[model samples]
Target chain A: MTADLFLQILVSGLLIGLIYALVAVGLTLIFGVMDIVNFAHGEFLMLGMYASFWGFALFGIDPILSMPVTAALLFGVGVLVYQVIIRRIINAPMLSQIFATFGLMILFRGLAQFFWKPDHRLVTHTLVGGNVTLGSIQFGLPQLTAAVGAVGVTAGLWYFLHRTRLGTALEATAIDREAATLMGINGQSMFALAWGIGAACAGIGGALIATFFPIFPEVGSNFILIAFVVVVLGGFGSIVGAFWAGIIVGVIEVVGGFVVGPEYKTAIVLSLLLLVLLVRPKGLMGKA
Target chain B: MTTIHLPKTVGALALLGFALLLPLVIQDPARQNFLILILMGAQLGVAWNIIGGYAGQVSLGHAVFYGIGAYTSTMLSLKLGLSPWLGMLAGGVVASAFSVAMGWPCFRLKGHYFAMATIAVAEIVQVLVTNSETLEGAVGLSLPMGNTGVAAMVFSTSKLPYYYIILGLLVVTVLASWAIERSHIGYYFRAIKDEPEAARALGVSLTRYKLVAIAVSSFFTAMGGSFYAQKEMFIDPGSVLATGVSIKIALIAILGGVGTLLGPVLGAGILITIEEYSRVLFGSTGSGTDMIIYALMIILVAVYSPAGVMGLLHELRRRIPSLRAKAEVRA
Candidate 1:
């Protein structure tokens, strides 16, 4: 391929990777703190997209302008799910826990279909609708904004976890639940916080991508597998690992699709996941 | 170890006798088709229970084996004009080989990780099947029209043959599971499920036993797939290899009570009946209603009774003094 085409592919991969990282960060965070893989996580992303879509289509508000509203809405949903269903199964068997989340996945998807119908919808004439030309390369403005939003959200999360006391307490609970409980940290609150933050991350990702991608109830399925691959490839519970792994997966998916065939793009990403899992289950940055 | 309780054995045999006579009594083609579906569900559930229930590995990607079985038999029949019976056996072997490759690497991870890995593997298989030209990709393959015969595993008019065939398959799977439950392998499987570390320390080769379980499980699942292909007269990646199919298989086992000899059979009967009825009542417009009901049932079962329908029966047996007395007498 020519240098310009290569650069275009590389940049596009990087942008898509950022969104994947954002979605995966939420999944990894929940897994890190509570050791529960949220199978309904993709539903949260779907909800976010719908939130943005409705905001744009019904109220004449741009998706970018309504990103916070979508995030807050998802944050409440995360907490509600924890309170209603997840809290009861916190100590249940592994199989039960899995089915519980899987059940939630079905419930949410079904609810979406019930309420909104199964037709695909998209946000048109959004604020970030045009393409930008930089020298020899051109890129969509929505993608660039979404990429920047991902970086900002990720940085803010990192700062919150590392610099703030509340975040430290949450991290401490993740490290040792009993010790954190002994230290007078409310474990329940921390768990709820993790869910809130996790859902918000996915919501932000959904809102950002709503500008460019089609929105549907089953849209979550399209990205959920890729997000899981990212979470595993980055290590089970490492944020930074998820970030870099997301980029790697994105690049592999796009470049592999270009080189081999687009139909096998998903296969390429999943194969990378299997390889990493077989060779290094702990992932690149995950603590052994 | 092969000893069977008299009452339970007699009860199961009576149930089997009833099932055998069902197709003859039920003349309506639609009702016969429903029974066939229930039998198929039972067979698939029993197959999954071998690994997911007995070995305690929650595989969400079992559709890989199912799809493999379907694709193998369909290709063999379409390409070489082979009998589906032989193709079915070939499908089972192919699926078992794939299972070994998958289970070896995936068995290392526990719980959700194992489940996630299985999903990825299934997705990979689906993608590969969808892309391959020989498999006809997304357009899929249809078996050529030919003379109906027992050897071809094709029947044109009556649904009775298909019902009996699947019923026979279900019986074989249940008997195999029952035999395993009473054998030394059963103890080893339970040990691994209860405590993997403890089982390993006691000289149980975790990988070997788990692989054996998954191999058996995948083989039967693939056989079911082959049966499904011949019965439907068509095979497609979307139909046979979808993640939804895998989830339904797991749900049937879970809902019936995993690891029990007859749990999957019972679970399959209840779930398939409910699913088919819901589809009939709502038609295509009520697209997500059946799923909502299934989801609610799964959540309720997981939260309230992880042991499923069998667990409820056990609880009932415990609650009633007369029932407890009869149970003690049987024991």
Candidate 2:
């Protein structure tokens, strides 16, 4: 392959990888705090895509301009979901927890189909609507913007978690729920906050992906599996781990697809997952 | 534990009698097909229960074994002109071997990690199968229609043979489960599930027992898959290896009562009936109404009845004597 082509592939992979990181970040956050994997997580991304789409299609508001509203809307959705369903399953058996989220996944997909009519919607005309050419390599402007936006959001989340008092409390709660409770940290509220923020992260990622990708009820399924691979590759419940793992997965997917066949890309990524499980079950950065 | 309650035994025998005689009375092909579906579901669920329910390793990627069975049987018949009966056994053996291989590395991870790894492994297999040329790739495989009989295992004239075959399979699975439940291996499995560390402390080989559970589970699950391939006369990755299929199998076991011997059968009956009827009523609109109902049922069952339908029955049975005693006190 030509150097330019390789650079192009790398850039494309990086762009998509950033978005994957954003999505996995939310998922890892929720798992980190609550020890529950939200199978409905992809639906949050789907909802965000729809949020952006409706904003554009109905009111002619650009998706970029509506990003914050999408995030807020999804945050409320996350909190509502936790308060209604997740709260009850906090102490349920792992089997029940699995089914509860699995059921939620189906429920959300069904609801999306019922309300949105199962058709693929897109924000066809966005402000970032062109291509950027540089040094014999070309990139979609929307992809670049999405990647940049993803980085910004991830950075903001890191700042919140590491620098803020509320974030520290949430972190502490994640480390030891009982101790945090004893310290007067309301574990329930912390869980609620985690869900809200987690959903918000997916929403932002969705809004970014909405710029270049088609929006549909089943779109979340496409990303969710990849996000799972990323989460596992990065080590579940580790934010920094998810960030780098996402990029690595994305690059491997694109480059591997290019080298082998696009049909085998998922197989390649999933093989990596199996390899990681066999060699290092805790993942790259997961706690021993 | 081995002491059998007379009433329960009688009820079981009666149910078996009803199952054997129902097809003779009902001639409707669609209803017969529905019955076959329930049996198939129950078979897969029972097989899954060995590892998932008894051993407490929640493998969400069991469709891989099912698909392996289907493919193995189909390939044998299509390529070598072997009888599907032989293919069925071969499929079971192949699936068992595959399960052992998969469980070796996967058993190290606990809970969700193991489950997710299973999913990943199943997905990779599916992708590879879809892209494979020798296995016919996405085009799938079809059994020849020239021969029709018990030997061929293809019954186009009537659903009766298929029904009896699956029912027989289900009975064998249930009996195996019953035997295991009464055996020391079953105790080891339960100990591994409920008290892993203590079981390990007591010198129980957790991984070895886990592997045993998966091998047995996958063997039976493969038989069900082979049955499906024969009944449908077709094999495809989409049909046999989908993650949805895996989840459905596991859910049937969960919906009934995972560890209970007959729970999966009851679960399969309810779940398949609901699934089929809903599809008939609401599937054409493409509005996903059936999915909504299915989703709601799963959610409600998971949320309110974690112990499943069998657990509810046990609870009701426990309450009846107390209620009767209260009435006697009042009198």
Which candidate tops lDDT?
2
Q: The CA-based lDDT of model 1 is what?
A: 0.91
* Candidate 1, Cα interface RMSD: 1.1
Give lDDT per model, in order: 0.91, 0.91
Candidate 1: which stretches are off by over 4 Å? Answer: B322-331
TM-score chain B for all models. Answer: 0.95, 0.97
User: What lDDT does candidate 2 reach at residue A248?
Assistant: 92
Instruction: Report the backbone clash tally of model 1.
Output: 0
lDDT of 1 at B74: 90
TM-score top scorer: 2
Candidate 1 CAPRI classification by DockQ: medium
lDDT of 2 by residue, B48-121 (tens): 99999999999999999999999999999988989989999999999999999999988998888899889998
Which pairs in model 2 have colliding backbones? Answer: none
Query: What level of docking quality does candidate 2 show?
Result: medium
Lowest summed lDDT over 10 consecutive residues: which window, candidate 2 chain B?
B282-291
